[model samples]
Target: MAPGEKLDPLPDPFILQPPAFHPVVPYVTTIFGGLRAGKMVLLQGEVPLDARRFQVDFQCGCSQHPRPDIAFHFNPRFHTTKPHVICNTLRGGRWQAETRWPRLALQRGAGFLTLFLFGDEDVKVSVNGKHFLHFRYRLPLSRVDTLGISGDVSVKAVAFLNSNPFVEGGSEYPAGHPFLSESPWLEAPCSRALPRGLWPGQTITVRGLVLPEPKDFTLSLRDEAAHVPVTLRASFADRTLAWVSPWGRRQLILAPFLFYPQRFFEVLLLCQEGGLQLALNGQGVGATSLGQQALERLRELRISGSVRLYCVHC
Candidate 1:
């Protein structure tokens, strides 16, 4: 990238079975292939300014008269003076004891990313990119086949990932899984054309496993003139992440580099009005500012380095 060439933006890449975008409130859907260890459900949306509260429930079925059993109920109560979260289970139409968490990491009227990771004994919930709490399984997870969300909240996307992205050969996803079967792994040094170019509010997700004995890998965004506008490098040996440009390279040392060899990672790049926000495994990492014109020039995404890419959702 040229020193003053201006960093370009990354466009929205074509995706297979992209997550449900802008679903109606009080949404419900079957948990494809059912819940199992290593699977994950990701909800991305904004908490409305006037939001009172919201709940995410895992149910056995959508029955009404006999009310479907709730395997897990995760509710964030913002209406209360002291914001908190309540977790519980419902069996035989009766609610069980409630577990309360006194902290609320979500902000009103802001975008948020929440993840529910299914494990053997509990479900790990993370808000944005930070680990929040775990809800032990009262009802067997095997009995949970449907997901329901209701209350004062707006949902942008609801995605189900069949397997953990961090483990090598984790759980095997069923054939035709949208995340895997459709957008299969791509070889290293991969490059894809970004026809639409990135726009404000667009996001790009790169999921991959770092190779053992890794050196470094770079993700770059180039313009139509083939000039790199933005480039980020993760150096395993140096334990640093660098922003490269014609001017020079700026590096930040991470106590323990997140891009370690044999590690699984999901990187999210969110395009904003005048900058790009980056996150690793759901945690905010870094961001860079660029002019509006510069962001409009981004036309391609190039992923080259020491990593095996499982998928790229632009």
Candidate 2:
């Protein structure tokens, strides 16, 4: 990227079957095939309630005593009155000039999601569904071989997502799996697979507040074969709340409708035998039959409407 050029949110890259990391504290994991552009790493964890700071490092290797060359250091300091994300590189036993991004994207004592998008010019990071920081590279991508995170943080999972293939049968899109852009949180026209992979008993919850007097919103769940098993539609335009296949041969399902304009609410779609159950805030809204396809085959969630979605979890 040119100096001072704007870095927009990264477009969705193809995701492989997310390899999981459930490491002990002071974690260090090697990147077996090395890092490059079009690859991203997802770190999910919680900062301690009393966390003063924590650090994540992209190192040349996982060596200690005389630590390996640090290609990128991400340190978030909470000790100061105003928090900042500190970025730097270490080479020849000296630290480079540090860059501070004045954003405290991590929440105290709560889980946070951080995505590091690797590119030729810089590494852009997003935290908890929002853009956080970026750091220009001071080392070639070739030298980095390990990833480490340490200090006052409880890590839940670390996943390395590589979109471009450099080896035979590498971590690319699986043959039969449905693929699409990763969902941009709170952004309409959003869609992605359930990150942990959907299961039979899992409940998919979408929580959002309507943007003051919203006209309409729609959320859909689809199977691998492109079958939309269940779809929820809320429209003030037509004064209707309906389920999928409105005009198709399949019958439509309607719920005991209620509206909370300009207020927060959650829609829970639970997968179970016979059909999908819909619940608003905690009570049953309705049920819609999605045929007899296996639960594991339901692979995608698509949401697009005039609303700001805060969370979608299964």
Candidate 3:
């Protein structure tokens, strides 16, 4: 050491060093340790046992002031193999856990990693390098002791750093849904070529011709008999559309410029018992109900003259 000399950034004290022996064995070696930052271990082997028997233990910081950062356990007998993250925070000297799974989890073979951070207002969970959850006020300062991970299967990689977590949009909506159409509006001379009949549990795809106005308009399904109208409005502002139920008159502003004109735009409306479910192409957008009045008695299922750029599908 010399005076007035700057010191190099010290290597991560938590870095996991090479193990002297095989850190993990078949079923007996359930816990593995010796990383400066944290530790990762796998459970569940070829042995015939209940999935719940698999457990993970996490010891944070140092042995003198060890903090139980996180732990995970699963059982296979009663549940199927699915990826998920469980979060917890210490409140009033008590630990509370919250389980969160991304919408993408509905798909098969999706794996996710849980990140715990300090000074973070929310827990950021990522799957396949895509951020999914932005949970607010989940982990507090006092509750975060040490960060660790454990699972039933082997982890590809395990590392931690001082960074903020965030949530990124998934493939729930096609890229074109928000980018292709801008300031989408319904064209005039709009007519429901399909006959008005009992559309119970049916989805009616509406195709209309867009005019040169370059303005956004709402496609509304009105049951004249009940004075209820369900509207779906699309806009270029966010490159997405929303459904607005007849919950009294509502208004939404669209972008000033038009993106597509004289082009055919399509939306699907699902027929339900009391209301209709609206969606863009095949993605679920929103829904609206028919209220006490029976929607079957509708005389006209045409677009109401009242048009807007905003509609929240019920």
Candidate 4:
């Protein structure tokens, strides 16, 4: 532990585990303990074909009389031809100024997953594994103890993820191939840790299903340095992989194609002792030089594509 650094505890890994899948609309639930900075909430749902607007709210209390104070009000309006996201706060049944983003991150009738990354200053909304927008904090974050959602949306499920690795669950460091149960995850296009940080003998895994209407997808690793090393991409056309780096190095890797409606693929990437190794399914596909300085500098794992990202083990 660093001197004077606070060891913030993470919520129990099982805290947000839903009892069962919810495929209904106008859903509401408590966020267990409350809302806190560094907690990410995942909402998987689909907008109805005739949907107009839907709202996701973070409430300080779950009272119904005279209405509870809302800490964060995230509403997506797609009524008319135009669509946008409105962010606001409500106190004493009154709303404050609103901020709007002119983008519809969710599509009608398409199952989508949105992540609300709660931070000290604001909450960043990412839809379908991409950065969307951020809304600043308008109320004391400590007061937010409940989550509520309503309007024209079909909710598949919801989960909460606390970023700290050492807090409640024993996800800190898993031996051998860490199963899906021992990792902190986001929808995708996200950065998560391996045990704690980059270390020797650590392995990286990404498992997802390629969508039928897919073109290609990419996964990259970054560092504080300007040079980001090892970006792995798979081409849907010929079942080939592109192993490249931000420094302009490319290695074409060919892997056998698998056909089916599922269209599943698992890519394992690792950077250790010798160099970078990438494998698809069980095939050794490509490699990249693992610079010595890049060891501890390797910060995150990112995947972007038309696939339902299952798990990313870093």
Candidate 5:
């Protein structure tokens, strides 16, 4: 082997989009790119030990002055001996007739994952990855772009994922071969839109090759207001992986640097209730915490620096 030889660059991984980790209770964030069929919103957290009830609302906006419209209001009541869930909508600040589901899918002091899958006519809900129920949309899904969660729960993460990428965004990929479709290799220093925004249980995978004379490269998840939720910086010279929080604080990891000059690498970022978990080449790296930033507002992915990108999937 040559003493000063460089390896070839590598390919990227599939991104599951950005996700919000360990968000505060009573959380509300704008849903960028709006709602559509084939998209799913995931919530992972725990019900408080001494909790009574909680509510998750899909609203038009986060306006308090006039009170924005609520397209879907999912309220779980533990006040009664037999817990139940109530689904309703609020339009013009008036409550509509509620539909009640007698079954309670969550319990106190336990972690849970709730998934909301959007469809053309209704939203199918599941708990712990199993189908629970379906609710017909009282209002158009497009009108609901804000997600609000409140009361009696400690949220871990929130993720917005696409189950059917071929049908999304009018992609030119043929529907007959969904599994064979891969995005074309994108250039570095590029930005991609996260149509629905981040939530819990979402994963974003990045694959690229570190340049022969690499310095550093960064991947950032930002929102419409320029608020960044998470950023990953890989420094070749320093041999470090820096996890930048939403507050601009850096938590540098110095144990193992996964990037090498002209080497292809796949980095996976998983959004959980606690934080974002990093994995390099299928090995666990570490995690970083997010501030009180609303992850759903993180609608853009920006990648820059010394890496040559192969592709990005979100």
Candidate 6:
């Protein structure tokens, strides 16, 4: 694809399946897969109270899989609490459960069981054979401090099993998951060669917000077609970037917002002479103009190599 060309939409990575049960302890454990690969349930502990007992639970999707995938329950009534599950998908995103199970009854001889089942288009939960909660969408594989069960029972086993192929290989958070360092601002790299055609008065503006960080980073805009790079420097200490017009000027101030490594950032570029406009995610902060001087000489716009995640005008 040409520089600045649009990209296709992201695919869903969640697999559907029946619910499963498992046993767990007070420590953080993976009820299913590693990292954010398949379906993973995480567990933790919290303050103890004199209320009904509940077993913390983590559930997964069931649109594809037909069997109970995984489960984890804690032992030692008040001795150990705070269990959670980290539900993840093959693509990205996560959900967490941390509510205590209400003081309820279970099937005779049945201990407190935390279930993760796939129900219709949502993920449902049941404790001691009693229905509790349901999630409408697939949860991404991320860390969460939620997942509680309340009842008059104790946890026993934390099992992991799946009858579906789609949900087997993917883990909740595999050890080899890709990692991107934290940054205050990011920019999509430009192409090396400018477009072949030319049109005077053609202009494009690239804009984005500054992330919340202690230091500032340089935002570089490259005209891949022209093989040029324009750099903008800004700070993310305050966490905001507003729009600043750069007409007939070299640099402009964009919006102001705290940088969040977990959230999506945006950038906007307007191409008037060409009758086109492009907005991108991860384009970096600040504002600037690609005036008729150089934009008129370009044919293609694209993000350079290894410059971080890039999303086209969405």
lDDT of each: 0.74, 0.68, 0.36, 0.66, 0.72, 0.34
- Pitting candidate 3 against candidate 6, the one with the higher lDDT is 3
Q: Write the number of the candidate with greater lDDT, choosing between 2 and 3.
A: 2
Q: Which ten residues in a row are the worst by lDDT in model 4? A: 170-179
Per-residue lDDT tens digits for candidate 3, residues 48-124, read 22323222323333232343443222211213464353434434335566544423321223233333222234333
- Model 2, 183-239: lDDT tens per residue? 365478678785443554567766555777677788877777787766788765644
Query: Cα lDDT for residue 127, model 6?
Result: 50
Sorted on TM-score, best first, the list reads 1, 4, 5, 2, 3, 6
lDDT per residue, candidate 5, 1-314, as tens digits?
25986543323222233456677887998776677766567787888878899999989989998999998888888878899999898999899999988879988888888888777888877787567778899899989888999999888767665543313342211111111112354667878898787677677766666778887789998888887778888766657678887777788874455577776566667776656777665445578775334666678988888876654666
Local lDDT at 262 for model 1: 74
- The residue-by-residue lDDT of candidate 1 on 80-192, one tens digit each, is 99999999999999999999998897778888888888878888888866788988999988898899999988987777654423234443221111233223347778888
Q: TM-scores, in order shown? A: 0.53, 0.50, 0.30, 0.52, 0.52, 0.26
Displacement of residue 144 (Cα, Å) in model 4 is 1.0
Q: Which stretches of candidate 2 lie above 4 Å from their native place?
A: 1-18, 163-314
What's the best-to-worst order under lDDT? Answer: 1, 5, 2, 4, 3, 6
Output the worst ten-in-a-row residue range by lDDT, candidate 3.
Answer: 173-182
| Per-residue lDDT of candidate 6, residues 92-168 (tens digit) | 23223423433332332333444444332444545534455545444433332233444544343333222122123
Measured with C-alpha atoms, the lDDT of residue 81 in candidate 6 is 47
Deviation in Å, model 1, residue 162 alpha carbon: 3.4
Candidate 1 clashing pairs, residues 3+ apart or interchain: 7-229, 11-198, 13-314, 129-282
**Worst 10-residue lDDT window, candidate 5:** 172-181
lDDT of model number 6: 0.34
